[model samples]
Target: MGARCSKFSLCWWPSHIRSNRHDSSDVDEKDSLPGFIEYSLDQLRAATSGFSPDSIVSEHGEKAPNVVYRGKLEDDRWVAVKRFNKLAWPDSRQFLEEAQAVGQLRHMRLANLIGCCCQGEERLLVAEFMPNETLSKHLFHWENQPMKWAMRLRVALYLAQALEYCSSKGRVLYHDLNAYRILFDQDANPRLSCFGLMKNSRDGKSYSTNLAFTPPEYLRTGRVTAESVVYSFGTLLLDLLSGKHIPPSHALDLIKSKNFLMLMDSCLEGHFSNDDGTDLVRLASRCLQYEPRERPNAKSLVTALAPLQKETGAPSYVLMSIPQVSSSSKQTVPLTPLGEASYRRDLTAIHEILEKVGYKDDEGVANELSFQMWTNQLQETLNSKKQGDAAFRAKDLSTAIDCYTQFIDGGTMISPTVYARRCLCYLMNEMPQEALGDAMQAQSVSPDWPTAFYLQAAALFSLGMDDDARESLTDGASMEAKKHRN
Candidate 1:
């Protein structure tokens, strides 16, 4: 099974040095964590005239991401107040933690974290309001009015520098580095914001995510190393260059073909000069390197982005560059009817949320459509695979993984099947570092699948752990008759 499974994108059991990059710790608690803007819910109400809709400076229509409030701080500086409605409460603690961190770490490129209000089950974060909105707005907001590459480069520099500051402060992880999180200043400099999910290790595991901005390691393991952040930075660069959310495709293959220049954002078609675009692309590629150790840190990122700043005077945005391959390669994946049920169930949950939000409003429809389009795209990808293969295919690793997740999530998948499918996904997703997670997950649900150990060993090897993989492979080799049967 191990020999059959190895591929260009083999799962490697990765290194383990957990950093609760995005989760909060209780060592200091809310009290010891200083720098509170110290205002009651009532004061906040007065600032924004009782959270009036008219006070809203900007709302993009997403029911959850929407920030509703208009307010003035006591010092007379205008501010934008973002309040978390009941729907976002589950992620609210993140907001409070960020409010504390960013509020204290002041910089010209950063918004003044005025303070926050956590009261009566209400959550609100206050920051100096930038009237201009996010950098993403000007770049991809409209194809006709794309931002000049110069501006994006400047934004990248600003982001890198800000992250450098955060990273230097002993240890702090700015978890969300997407375009939406970057608010622009009057002069067009970008300040990282929306940091409710920033990770600062104190005690216990405190962060979890599968955001595209994140590295596969964090998705598989609940930890944040600076290298993972660099990986995310690369993706952001790609977005900046492309002015679109480029999906995970065969990027590594593109780079290998030396045609990575073609992957430049369509908006920069004519603007890219010889050897110029290549500079930024190279920077992006470096950040996207699979091995976290191989990637640069924010400090190095600052150096990488500096050239563009010198060339253009402003920063250019880059989309998150990734090793451009589908999460699947030539690795076998098993499909079971149980996985289909979980997928349907996950869809139902999404649909139910839409219903609760009364998806009749234009914004609601837009957000729902965006989400459905994503799901539809996934379905189309899966359908394309199912049409070609029946039981298992080496190339269907990621697709099968998704299929199985849907099944398991739907609560219909049996024990061994769940592990079997998950093992495939974890391996292909470049998370060999976490095959054992599913081992535990599967073991909790059911036991007696020796195949898991074999799969785990492969995952371990992918991360360059030959000894572990060899040991597990020996245990999981199964009988020669069972193998030759294939």
Candidate 2:
């Protein structure tokens, strides 16, 4: 007879079997590459406040055709928006295909692509924002102490891993893999920019920097390949070794003359041993080999540098001396009932408050509809609100959302309370972006309503936006106190 199955037996399965299942699921998810989104142009515009000048984060000025802006999504998540010029990608389909391909890549070593936008005569790509800035600023023009030797080694290894992962996924061509393309995340870990994965333009020049830094093969063929990327990586290796950007040709000459000390950065003295220096220099020489086929692959580079890693147990933030707050440092603040629910992100308590308040706050708000239009649609709009209120009280979120959307689209009347109720419904359904939009709409309809700010705070907190949520909560508290005084 077959073995009998029981709950106890299910829980007592072999550890290796469970481990293998988990690993297989991870590989499947990575290969499938799900979760990439296509954002609307209006959404992107609102995120950047109509692409304001102050939001510009790209090193290139705003006049540059391809400019990157830092923006906050409706969900309160910060993102980097790269807007390409109109003529940059005239073929919208091709631009979208390339972005989709890059968006499929998800890795911790990369500033992974989040989404893209392709509207009429407009093309944009959205990526996870890196707040700390680029490798160029920190390495060459550091305001604080120079990047330590361990951090430099970590950057090299992390970059190699990024390239190796990309190559494994059949994305080997990286245009202009330089210090500027490398960025530091909030934790100060190095990440390769996904923007470099896509070509700038169909007929545009491949290399943006000086021709002296270009690979010999690229110069001859007028095209970049996997080997060309390896060549650029070698130049970056040289940059990390030296405090400044030295021409690759001159650096190779120094390497050939056995002047290892000359190639080393003065700031890195007393940090790395002679053996480590010699090993890195030899690796850089192999990467910069004249023959394209003779260069070591990314996997080999990882192997060569694995044993050279320093401070293996130390966190990147600590090694880089970047300030980070610990959980223990956070203090709890006393809050009113509504404030307490928002602070704790209690969706049910918020729903209860919405039901209790009802449309009492919306009283005396004027409607600008003409008599004829009001007579035509007033009953229909009122019916939609009545149904939405019933669904909201019944805790039927989907029905409530549908009814509220109907009432909103009717255009005969405006109700901030209805928007707030729909905002809570969206939150309970795990749609924070839509919830945030509704909350903002509520504030626009009734700017002084403290409940609008409270709902906004709840939605922001749900999106992991602690700082913005706290500010919104404070605003709500102040408004409530002011109303009481009146």
Candidate 3:
């Protein structure tokens, strides 16, 4: 269970544009919040391919209490879906109310809440998807070079602006604020996740990280104040400076000892001036003060960091080396017949091809059992295959998957075709991750099989890994050409 915020006043627009008088231009109450949508469960399911495991983008994966999934809308707009656990927000009405409050907020510095769903016992929130991933991934466990000093400073400033905006909108508290809560948009600019603006549960447990990272006041009061958010922001500042999670106390000690240079990330060397480094360190120390009242507000934070910002003219994507693309842009790639079918997810075409191929390539792969006592086991395994094939032909995908599972578990036969068929079944059922596993299994059973690669491309396409899908499609075409020449 997590924390829940108190109900607050709602205004659709910023304070500057807010109007107290009703106008004829307001066509509908729902339309008042321009981009906010109340999505149906079925719509979300289709978007994320029935919430496939491969769609999960949260830091903790499926194991997280509330899982975040990357999904594309019917309009092809990418989104992040946060599915809260059953215990979170037991009262559906309260969940909707909170979602509405957060949904009204739209800020470039924030990963704005796009919509929410409250069907039955399920509680979910949807927001604009940030494709570049989270600060935790880039700062703490980056695969490429560590985040640049310019980008780091930009992230801090953007986050502060997000907080200030939320505060102005009367949504002040942010639960479990951490590196994971800061996401990089498609343009590589950092935006604070709106998910943190909503509470995880009603249990008064505001923080979810290690106790060391939790604000000391929260440890004692079991609550989070607006000031508590500033403390977490301090921790984030420390993360940017050190590229590590240094406990607040440890960070403050180093700051007090005049060990500011030691507190900075070694990777940041030659990238920032000593003065800039000292300024950020000093700001972090002020935010980490023992007295909550002494901490700076979000506005002050923005003011302090504004002058320290570097590379003011450069776009974030350039600094991060993330490819920039227009929203309407599409990748152009030549595809083979099967590859084209996969790209379009044309199940009818895919089915016809699989039916034509049948199990010709899998013949004689099964080992014959020498013992007569195991004869019944072999018969059962063969029976499962027959049932699976029959179900697959009839397009009873669930039944086909069950029968295929039984055959795979039997271990008496090795049929690449069975894996390929099951892979198609999983795809038709909108379970791309499972389909991917089956496709990989098919490849291991018969490495040169073009069908396996084609199936892989289909699953990858469904999961929105377009670049990988293109490569797989090319491989499948190459293998098909080699087979034709043979």
Q: Who wins the lDDT comparison?
A: 2
Estimate every model's Cα lDDT from 0 to 1: 0.53, 0.79, 0.78
Better of 1 and 2 by lDDT: 2
Off by over 4 Å in 2: 1-34, 59-64, 200-204, 325-486
- Total clashes, candidate 2? 0
Per-residue lDDT of 1-486 in model 3, one digit per residue for the tens?
011211112211122322211111112233322477889999888877799886787634233567788777766566789887777788888888889888888777778888999998788889888766689988998754889998899888888888887887787899989998998875678888988888645533568747988888998898888999999999999999999999999989888999998899998889899999999999999999999999999888888988887887777866885533221222112234566577567777899889887889786575666576266687898889999999999999999999989988887777889989999999999999888888888877777777887888789889988666656765665566445335
Per-residue alpha-carbon lDDT of model 2 for 1-486, expressed as tens digits? 111111111111112211111011113234423367899999999988799886788845334467888877765566889988777788989989999999888877788888999999888999987766789987998754899998888888888888888888889999878999999875667889999999755434677648889999988888899999999999999999997899989999999899999999998889999999999988999989999999999888777877788886676766775422111211111134677578668788888877887789998788888888778988999999999989999989999999999999998898999989999999999999889888888888887787887888788889987667766766675566446435
Best by TM-score: 3
lDDT of 2: 0.79
Runs of candidate 1 with Cα error greater than 4 angstroms are 1-36, 57-68, 85-98, 194-197, 200-213, 310-486
TM-score, cand. 1 vs. native: 0.51
Worst 10 residues of 1 by lDDT: 318-327
Model 3 earns a TM-score of: 0.63
User: Residues 229-276, candidate 1, lDDT per residue (tens digit)?
Assistant: 677778788887667766434455566688876667776787767576
Clashes of each: 50, 0, 1
